[model samples]
Target: MPKKRRRISAFFKILTVLTVACGVLVAGGYYVIRSVQRVELTPPPPPSGCTLTAAGDTDELEVEQAANAATISGVAFGRDLPPHAVVVAFATVWQESKFRNIEFGDRDSVGLFQQRPSQEWGDPEQLMDPVYSSGEFYDGLVEIAGYEEMPVYEAAQAVQRSADGFAYDQHERRSRTMAAAFTGAEGPAVTCWYDTDEAGEADVEAAQAEMDRVFGTDGALPAAESRTGDPGWAMAAWAVANAERYGLTSVEYGGQRWSAAEGIDGWTEAPGEGGGAAAEDQVVLR
Candidate 1:
């Protein structure tokens, strides 16, 4: 009888140990998931029957594409964020750094959102990642007390805390128009560029070539001024918004080994370096 009781006690002890071990494992798994989140930036699907062709012009298509991409990404996580939200974010990006994830900053800012690595947004790579930066922006938006309920620009300002807070107002309208087109739930770089110089001119050519190969088109996208709601500006803004990620500066893309010869308007105005203001205005989606 004594031996049997001892055996039973040992079994209970073993069970308790196993239970504790499982609890630890489960907690560890949850922590890992929260830390390394897998965020997909895919845009929304087109409404029943819509295509890029319906945009009538590239400018319109650009707006549409931005709207689509932003809206899709906003909505994808089951968040139901408005298209205007994305517009606000895109416009802010344009003004912030011409949408280029620059290595430069106020004292030493870097990445698309001009985030400071010291702030804990992430290490260098996280700041440079559009998806992560954008995700952080979106997360802040959702956390606001009445962000979605307020005017989009106001809501965005609440999250961005920009030096030029009031300026974000104008961008709200433009973002919606562009978001509509890119709504197919795409994660395709709503922005991109092939830096010929920083990337060794050939790399630029190769990137451009890849775009042409898959997209089947020339280097020149229809200018947004004439395209009207096409995804051009949105796409350009994305490229500008995330330019630093590709290792480019305004002067670099302006000419040099790359090809800013046209004196563009989407990311940077015809003006010199600090053109974040004009660039912000250019990609307004609405």
Candidate 2:
């Protein structure tokens, strides 16, 4: 009976060892498999706002400038102005304020275009407004004979009448980049990453009102109810240009999405509602 008991006890000990060994093998196999598998991590998008370069290079302020430049050029295009006008406007602004709407400048030079109130550009208050300053610049530009045929810097200098005529030349390349991206001449050219966390909900109403304030009540924007196509893209691009000030989170068009949180250097495929590149489309923000 004692021998029989000993045998049973030994058998139980073997069973226990086997159970622990199996557990160790199972755990080891799991670790090996996990280590061998490749885990792909999606890179985080850029900071919110806009990035103009292909390399995802740009700051919030510069992105704001790009967006404002888009609005300026967009308004010109809406008025049936030639493409050179947009380019010239961009270069001029780049030279003047680096696209900032400053309240101060060299001897009272103020606003995005650096239009001096002393020069009769407008009141100090009017010059602070980007739309008003852009209009003033265009007003002077269109008056120059054969301005359309002139070079971009020359055209800008003519309108600006700057002390140094060659200064505008420095901004020509960046101006062209911005003009092309915002004009929709280049597809998926402009991408902006902004702060969606603090931005809260998209403000379509404020965006529309600001659009009207800048582009005017003309047919520049689609009806509040809907938008699509090139016009839709144009409007959406405008929203992208102003995304920083407006708390706009994303602007979708042409089967692509530009999100502030995505920090994507450029537009990426967004194949869903309001994401199609149709003639009538929506500009999503928030």
* Collision count for each candidate, in order: 59, 19
Candidate 1 per-residue lDDT over residues 1-286, each given as its tens digit: 6999999999999999999999999999998897778665687432211123112323323322332243223322223345555566666665566555577788656766676667666777776655567666767777888665787667767877777777777765445544544432222213323322433322344434432322223654433332123333323433332233333333222211112322132222333444434333232111
For model 1, the run of ten residues with the poorest summed lDDT? 254-263
lDDT of 2 by residue, 222-276 (tens): 3333211134555667777677667776667656777665655657777655435
lDDT of candidate 1 at residue 179, scale 0 to 100: 55
Q: Each model's C-alpha lDDT? A: 0.47, 0.70
| Top candidate by lDDT | 2
Clashes of 2: 19
TM-score of each: 0.42, 0.72
Minimum summed lDDT over a 10-residue window in model 2 is located at: 222-231
Residue 180 local lDDT, model 1 = 47
Say which candidate scores most in TM-score: 2
**Model 2 Cα shift for residue 84 (angstroms):** 0.4
